[model samples]
Target: MKVKIYGEGAEAQELLDKVNNSLEDLGLSDFMEVEVTMDEELKNSLSISKTPALIIEEEAIDFRDTIFEGIVPSDEEVKSMFISIIGGGGESSGGCSSGSCGTCSTGCH
Candidate 1:
């Protein structure tokens, strides 16, 4: 799994720190690769409309999910996202299985 944080500022770096901390806390430091990017092409390809956006991709199956855009998620929120992804076998449990659960509050769709 890989996590990419898109932006070019302290906020982006802070998100990176939070992610690293969360991974360390969850004993998943070696399970994922984390990076912060300010590449315009990458941001455009991901259609990132805001700074400090986060994208989580499971490259094994070419699965890419946008966790958030335009905002900074809390440390716990970031941890929960990782938990959901790991526990659900790459499918985030916070999202609706049938796409009918609507407005999930777990920061995933």
Candidate 2:
């Protein structure tokens, strides 16, 4: 999954915890691979230009503030979102591989 949230501080850490707790409560915690930080090297490597950004498996999620504005995606919601994302032909967005089963792969996102 390789999830990275680009930012650090009490607020950022709090948001990270919220994300973890929310996901875990729904039993979808394993669906995510989370890393919290705002290191310059990490920002550059992840191509992040804004704080509070999220990179999911090499794909840029776009908004930095939006993700941490106290909003989190539900498991089914996340799944549906990625379905559209991958179907649009944008790097699979951590979904299934065509060679593996020709369908969404066990909700790898």
Best by TM-score: 1
TM, every model: 0.79, 0.45
Structure candidate 2, residue pairs in collision: none
What are the per-residue Cα lDDT tens digits for candidate 1 across 42-97? 77777888888888888789887667777777776777667666764355444332
lDDT of 2 by residue, 21-97 (tens): 64576555686677776578756764655555544553455433222222333444444434443364354444332
**Candidate 1: residue 74 lDDT (0-100):** 77
User: After superposing candidate 2, which stretches have Cα over 4 Å from the reference?
Assistant: 45-47, 58-109
**30 in model 1: Cα distance from truth in Å?**
0.9
- What TM-score would you give candidate 2 relative to the actual structure? 0.45
